[model samples]
Target chain A: MSTSPVTARLDRGVPRFGGFKLAIVRLEIRRQLRNRRTVFFTVAFPVFFFLIFGLNNAYASDPIGRGNESAFIMISMALYGTVLATSNGGATVSVERLSGWSRQLRITPLQPSAYIAIKMATSLVLGLVAILSVYIVAAFTHKPSMPLGLWFATGAAIWIGSLLFTAFGLFIGYLLPSENVMQLIGFALMLFSFGGGLFIPLSQFSHPLRVLATYTPLYGLNQLVHYPLVQGSFNWSWLSNLVSWLIIFTVGATWRFKRDTARV
Target chain B: MAERDVVPRTPPALELKGVRKDFGDVHAVRGIDLRIEPGEIVAFLGPNGAGKTTTIDMMLGLSVPSAGTVSVYGRTPLDAVRLGLVSAVMQSGGLLKDLTVAETVEYTAHLFTGARPVDEVMERAGISLIADRLVAKCSGGEQQRLRFAMALLPDPDLLLLDEPTQGMDVEGRRAFWKAIRHDAQAGRTIVFATHYLDEADAYADRVVLIREGEIVADGSAAEVKALASGRAVRATLFGADQATLRALPGVDHVEVHANSILLHCADSDAVARYLLTQTNAKDIEITARALEDAFVALTGSHARDESVQSNADEVLR
Candidate 1:
């Protein structure tokens, strides 16, 4: 066979990654947004939780921290946004892996970094969409006022918080058999929302569980984002906590993924 | 083409050397050694639990090999994507069923620079007509064809197809093979797996039969069939006696009835000579070895006996 055509093709040079990753990101966003289920779970679920909890606290007349319950719920809502991102994103990855879609991608010229980038980007978009929905709801119903700096801080925290926990979620989904992903996601969400005060305030929990929440990613996000939203100050300890957990999840997840899928 | 005009290419299109995959203690692929040149169609044939999928998985770098190495274009299969080489139509459906056929194919094509145009690939795969429809809305056969379109959109030099026609109707299968043959003739290397012996016999330049984690036979259709080393003779002889037919030399087995006889022999000429000597012989015909028969024989007498036993049991029940 002649090599001329192949040589010509090869000589065209390698593709740039910028457009490829963007395309993957676009595709991922399209797939999730187009699905009514995904939109409901990732975008609408957090809003529903916010309204339910906010309405209940509104009747207290003097909600926790002097009618500052709106600020507190805003932070909790961001944490719930992280949970939404991790659960939905991890589920997507798990389904793709189980159905051999990831295997199919390995054969294409789609770089692994590009693929992972799109997934992380997808998680960020989910987090962003969820947080934005809460922002809209809080403005109309809760009537919470915040400086632009705090809003930026909240958004940044949500993005990083989603990245950290979504990595953890991905690690669990990738390492565990596909059949167990949904069960694990449900369990993890329960732990975060009820035990770590993602929907309710941590003060409502008993002492030991509240202490345990201090070490969880959800607690770190709540503390980090809540400080700026409620007290109008950035907590350095919260930053340390969030970054530490991000390092742990990223390193641990990357290592586990490599060990599980590495080629001999 | 002058030799001087061609650049020296050091690596084969794909190679699997001593590759093995183990899922817990069960060895899926024991030790596979395969080399596909620049442009060749290699068919992998095996029964269930015969490591064909595992081997293809290793070659595509989906599952890590328990031992040895797999390389494509001198790079490991893990890194083949970086080299913009090799593509596959996996046994599992990988397309997002919610997307249109064109969307899936375009998404796949966008993964590589210099990929074939989406329309061209769809045309080549005979799926251009269904380009606008959602993948899930397509018929099973059309979905399979669209999968081929996605796999081929990159104009990958090496294509791996696992049971490409598993659900296709006759016409779909024929159309699929037509596209594959055109690709083969255009110098695209392919490794296809199928249970259909005729597909392998008709399309593949070489067929490799794998069994129990090892390659049992590898050759052209006729060459593999010849491994059985026997000829079949069936005759409806009016005056031949069963006992007399059994007495013929070199005949391994003989079944006789009132008007016909079936003889199994390793040598056709010897059987012909014996039949000619029979004065009562009225009708005789010799048949060439068939791939199906060769496959059954190569798999061993136990398998054949089990098949026979099952048929008999079915009839009796």
Candidate 2:
């Protein structure tokens, strides 16, 4: 019961992110890919939606910015896809947590910070696949047009933006019961998609509804990602909204995780 | 004496001082004190709901103690875990059904700083043959072995196994113990919980019996067996004399029922030998004291309720 040895060990600080953490993230991604059903639905559904909604002659003709209406819709669909995929990716933790796998991990030397990093990294990979699949389909169908740099930015923005929902997914996984978490995550993401003006344009909504959309979790990320295609003025409030929600979600997930492990 | 000042001696592998755990109204563990040295195979022998799992959980830092302290080596249980000095094979449900056995081991290896090679642990755990199979496709026994393989990845100093051979077949159980015994010979500490008396008696260097949230007995297997020492030798000897049966060495009591006689003694083997050789005894039956008797001996009595006794039934089985 001496404190000296502990202090000595503490002097040799353990790295939070290293080969071990990356290895877990890599393995997690591989495991997610092996679930063919989830892969097929998350990757294919968004592309399928983009084709159905954005491939019309009218959408291709109406110019919104440097691209056309089809380009704007394509970006929207990509954001929607990545949100679903990333949330689903993080939501799978609910099952893992319940299955005693988390309990198994509890006894190991893996630090809690490394675990969160692994989850976020793996979920971002899933989000990348989703958004890329949508973009590929859109390009193949000649549904959207933008500068080459904007296309890169659009994909990067949506992929990075998906981290918010990934943290939300992890939060929900630790908070909600595993059985209904997936269905619940899917439904909640759909509402966020609509409220954030991904499915319907915020410009068309009444001023009151538009103002309310600013407070929705997805609204900031949604508008900011569109800037790559729509080419609009930078809105500082958008960044603030996204950053605040991300902190809220990330903190919530960590809190729930600590609480879960304490009593588990 | 001069050398002792220059170098610190190793601490006990595990030390618990008045550890207690409570789940609201349920006192899962109540003030257990135990010290295990390195390389000792100690079995936490108990029936269901006897606080075996609760104590193990606290040892692994999976749950905090309601009171008291658990030290592994020289630090707290959680510190021991963080230092990668301890590992455990949990009772159940710590596997991903989708991952193959090999992937499971490999994935877990990534959590430790200098974990043993995946193939080495898998082969040592006797799970190499089923490495390619998905965990979902494995039998209960195979899954348990997979868990063992994962636990071995860290090459921990103290290994805790909770109901390790619960679902294993005879062959799997044999292989599991073979691996465990080999590790024991290598000077690693091991603590396992098992309801099977033979597992504790045959494998553990020491047996710590828990019942109704308390340590009822703690000693060598033979010493604990001595606590409930009497056995019976019953045989049909055709008009056996009660006076002759009572005169046998180690015989504590003798009961004659017409043509048959029952000898209750500390040594049943000698009594049986006498019945088979010295007398015309047929259909001889020698029975050792049951685990239930050991429980009764340690605790003075057992549960009167049918439900609680059913848990004891599992111990007998």
Question: Which candidate tops DockQ?
Answer: 1
Give the TM-score (vs. native) of candidate 2. 0.81
lDDT of 1 at B264: 70
Please give the distance, in angstroms, between residue A201's alpha carbon in candidate 1 and its true position after superposition: 2.6
Candidate 2: list runs displaced more than 4 Å: A1-20, A203-214, A232-237, B1-7, B229-317
lDDT of 1 by residue, B248-293 (tens): 6657678877788888777777777777774556467887556345
> Given the true complex, what DockQ would model 1 score?
0.39
The sequence of per-residue lDDT tens digits that candidate 2 reaches over residues B185-286 is 867789999877778989999999887778877999987766557788888989798889898898978988888888878878888888889999999988
Alpha-carbon lDDT, every model: 0.72, 0.82
C-alpha RMSD of candidate 2: 8.7
lDDT at position B295, candidate 2: 62
Off by over 4 Å in 1: A1-9, A12-20, A55-68, A179-183, A232-240, B1-35, B63-79, B132-139, B213-217, B226-294, B297-317
Quality of candidate 1's docking, in CAPRI categories? acceptable
Worst 10 residues of 2 chain A by lDDT: A6-15
Q: How well does chain A score by TM in each candidate?
A: 0.83, 0.88
Q: All candidates' TM-scores?
A: 0.77, 0.81
Q: What is the TM-score of chain B alone in each candidate?
A: 0.73, 0.73
Q: Score the docking of each candidate (DockQ).
A: 0.39, 0.31
